[model samples]
Target: MKKIGILTINDYNNYGNRLQNYAAQEVLKSLGYHVETVINNTDFNKKNNKSTISNNKIQKIKKITPQKILKKVALLLRNNYFYNKRLETFRNQRIKVFKEFTSSYIIETDISITESNIPNEIVDRYDYFVTGSDQVWNPNYRKGSPIDFLTFAPKNKRIAFAPSFGVSEIPKEYHQNYKKWLTEMHGLSVREEAGAKIIKNLTGRNATVLIDPTLMLTKEKWLSISKLPLNKPKGKYLLTYFLGDISRERKKYIKEIAENNDLQIVNLLQIKEKFAYMAGPDELIDYISTASILCTDSFHGAVFSILLETPFIIYDRENQSSTHSMNSRIDTLLSTFRLESRLAKNIKNNKEIFEVDFSHVQAILDEERRKTYGYLKAVLNI
Candidate 1:
């Protein structure tokens, strides 16, 4: 079997990252290729530490008024506890789940690579290199990391599979860099229409818009690995998987929806609520598949909800700004399935009854899967 090495943001403890990584591996395996996920230990460590530091700095700056500073200091002293412990706890729990679910599923390289140094022996070992199924090309996430561009690989061996830019447009500063790296790829595909447009603008290459790898797999394939917690609530539950902060009004709306529907609200990512700080990719599939309704601000959350045909409401990520907006991915996803009605903004009233007809969705998915498979087959010459 020809060896295929995948480079992606797999070490992050996010549901989408792991699931997409797993999906890419499985998809390639089904084509009879030997696959292994290339773990960049340096980038992994950087992402973990950088996110924590940046978040803390942002929060401190936001709350740095004179009175608020004093209040924060007083609260810190009064609590008499190491608040950083909470963050550590969350990180540890997420790492545990990542190891158990995501890590175990992929064939990982024995040797890890770093951003500054990639061993030539490792680079020459793979017949082909693939980057993506997530926001691997997003400048904000990478902070100018070129690993996703497959720069170290031979020009003919580089392949981009459903890698997303995660933005509607590439910033002007990065256009030249993008052109330099992406122009050499043997095959290029993106996860959204906007991403394809960016590639076209930057490299003058018409890129194919492919479905996320998670969507490329059948629901049965996902269910085969799903795990449900023994303590999962009985009966109807409103499952939420918000990655961003939830606003007061949105929280109230969710609560009201649960109360009216006689459902319990189960938050999957709210660390303070303690609902599910340890949900792995399998558990996430289980939750979405079994939930009576889903409310989320995450791209994978919406994808799973749609795939499972669960009633769902997708809210825009909170406090979206000029530098980064997650709306494009969600918009493209919903539009692809003709499910734009699922956006929370489209609903005039919280009390209004909502439903999704997946009959049409299934047709679209079937066609997309064919196109995606064709692209991969032709590109890999499988």
Candidate 2:
């Protein structure tokens, strides 16, 4: 059988990242290829990402008053970055759950590839290396990480499958490097329309805009790997998952919705909710698929909700102006599915927001899956 290596984000903390990684691996395996997710971590990526982060922090500090900055810092330390950051207890169990899902579901290469050790022989181990199904191309997040582009592999052996830029425009700092690496890839496809535009502008090559790999699999397939949480409530509930900070007003909106609908509110990402917060890729499919309604600011959160045919509202995540924002991918997703009305900023007395029509979604999903499969088949020559 032909062999393929998958390269994606190292963040197992993220539901989207791991889900996409698994989806990419599963799709490749179904195509009759031996697939393993390459574990790549590097100090080079870390240093660059840190530099960018510190620079952004510095810029942020420069704009705010000393009192304001101190208040923000104290707030972050106290509430742990408003629920995005967690105490050691949350991280410990959450990471364990993440790894459990990964070990059980994703087939990974035995070797951990890093900057210091590139493993020259490994290039021959896999027929092709594919960077996929996530925002691996975002310079703010990736720091123009060469590994994400599979630069160690021969250009003909490198393929980018539905990787996203995550922003409308590339920062000027990463332009040259992005252009060079993107141009080198043999087969290119992106997850969002904005990503395709960026690819065209950088490489003067039009890339196919493919659906996220998570959507490639049917509901029954996802359910095959899904598990119910042991402590799940016996009652109907409204599910909320937010990767960004959830403001007081937003929480009020969620509470009001749950109260109005006579449903329990379950915040999957809330660190304080120890029982439900330890959810992994496996349990989340059950949580999302069975929810009465879902509210989220995450792209993947919206992705699964749509796939499960659950009523959901996509809130615009915080920190939109930052270069690191990945909201463009979410925008492209809603537009593609004709669900633009679901995005909202204010939820005061909006009864119409709860009603979603999934009647037209399956047809779009069918066409998208066909196109994605066609692209993968031709690109990989399977």
Candidate 3:
């Protein structure tokens, strides 16, 4: 059996991240390979919590006010102390659980939490290294350079499976950096076609556009292990993926659109009972399964909507510069599936947002799933 090391984002509660990890694991296991997700021993809840609200823009806005100054100081001091205590508790509880989870699983591959944990010897040990499930190549994740992960593993045969460079346009400076690293890859597949174009432009290689890893697994497989709620209301509802706080005007428009439809408006970003950013894979699946329609700003939100045969309206971010071409990846998917009407060109002031029809696009996704299976078969040589 070929030993494979799967590298991906699984620390966060992002549904796309978990689904992608599960998809790759499922596909590899079905192909009869010995596989394990390389987990890092890195501490997520260190002295500074990565997901803390203080690091966010809201805290930055409160920095300049006199009253907010005292509040900020108090918040910082409290946050520091609270953060330290949470770090210890989190380390004791979560990290211990992670270690136990890793050990319990039949993991042949060594898991490294941080890029630093990936040793030179471990790289040489694995036959193939699969890097990516979501926006792993995004500069934000890679500390300003998406290809920084490549610098860590020199000996292993590397491949990027359904990797996204995040948004559309990469700067000319990063383009040169991408050219050097991407040339070394064995196989390149991107989640979006526009991302393929970007990669092709840089490497002169036609990247195989694959479905998001989550699509590789059927709903049955997901349902078996996923945490789904019982007794969903038997009515039509819209799945709203507004993690980034939509304006009141947009919220009003959505309500107007759902006036008669019994819309099940699910704000994935809304603070849950636990005060986390959003629900995990199980919670998201339940939300997606019941939603008759979806209005989303998240890439994965749109993805799940399509997979579940739900009609969707995507609110892609506005690109102000020619250099900012991130939405093309999403645009390619929307256009290919003939769901251009469902894509909101203007996130905030979309006058025609209510005009999306889901029937034709639902059929298109069915056809795409067949193609997705074929791609998987080819990749796995099944």
Please report the candidate that would top lDDT against the real structure.
2
> What is the TM-score of candidate 2?
0.89
Better model by TM-score, 2 or 3?
A: 2
lDDT of each: 0.83, 0.86, 0.63
For every model shown, the clashing-pair count is 0, 0, 12
lDDT tens string, model 2, 242-321? 98889999899789888888899888887778888888888999999999888999999899989998888888887667
- What are the per-residue Cα lDDT tens digits for candidate 3 across 16-110? 66666767777767767777777654443452336644445466756568767877767777877876786565445433433443344325343
| Better candidate by lDDT, 2 or 3 | 2
Higher-ranked by TM-score: 1 or 2: 1
Could you give the C-alpha RMSD of every candidate to the true structure, in order shown? 2.8, 3.8, 5.5
Question: Model 2, poorest ten-residue lDDT window?
Answer: 44-53
User: How does candidate 3 score on lDDT?
Assistant: 0.63
